[model samples]
Target: MHLFSENLAVEIATYYRNVALGHSVVPKVFTLVNGSGSQYLFFIDDLQMERADEDQFLAYIVQEHDAVSYSRGTLVIVEKNQQYIEFAVVDEDDSEAIVCSAELTRDMDDKPIGLSEFEKILVKRESIVFGHLYDPVKLSEEKIEDFESLWEEMKPKILHRTMGV
Candidate 1:
């Protein structure tokens, strides 16, 4: 699919804003499929990092990776847990696998660091990218089921608050 970056950006922004406003626990990201395939990018949210553990962190990466793989597109997971969030890309084609991590560091002058430093860090994390292939069609269907389950779980809480039952 020929995914447009702008559309993806908008989706990511909207998702993030909703999450920030206490609308949902769903991760903020955009998923689009074009003629070529599908692509996703999780927006970095510094505030959400506090609740992130290594398992959740890794699972998030794997989830995105699987999403792209299933949709036959590319997935980019942006890590907002740290001062400098990193973007890690995963491709469906094994041969196209190129893992990189970049950190945004500020200099003494309060200016951003150069691309060279970013590239260096990206190169260093190449060995960490690992995950199984995920089918988007199946995942999409499963997500619907999950959402319904979530609604069911919240029904009691909502009723309790509204009716004092």
Candidate 2:
């Protein structure tokens, strides 16, 4: 509904530029929610549609996900069942990246854990962030459709960033 930050202005501009140039911008688009730390950050796009409210937004996503048979874009819903490693999630000059970790994590309750469990804490509050969400990954149409389930399968092989360089 709104730019995640003032920096997103450039991201929005780039989206338009790529659209104008007919580039495959899907990979570059990063839709997010200011879930306010109550929800797992997810990368979701509304296909650039406008909604009057949260109900409308979620409904649109569910409908479109089905109408296209979940074959259109990426969907990464963070879940606790998967293995996670610490990374420095950095925001720099209108861009974001997950970088090598210093090795530590904390849950939503702000509790230090033997291991990181971000999504789990958020999920315990609810199945998924109802009003907002966050996830960390990329996708293909086929993979996007079943992303939540296919995440582990693809995590090891995709993304230069995920390589833990």
Number of the top lDDT candidate: 1
Counted clashes in each candidate structure: 5, 6
Quote each prediction's TM-score.
0.32, 0.21
TM-score of 2: 0.21
Q: What TM value does model 1 have? A: 0.32
| 1-165: candidate 2 lDDT, tens digit per residue | 122332233333333334323532223123322223111122233223333333343334333332111111121224543323321222212223322211123346533233322221111212222322222223355644543443344335332111010
RMSD of each: 12.5, 18.9
| Whole-model lDDT values for every prediction | 0.32, 0.28
Please identify model 1 stretches exceeding 4 Å from their true place.
1-38, 44-86, 101-105, 109-113, 117-130, 133-144, 147-165
Clashes of 1: 5
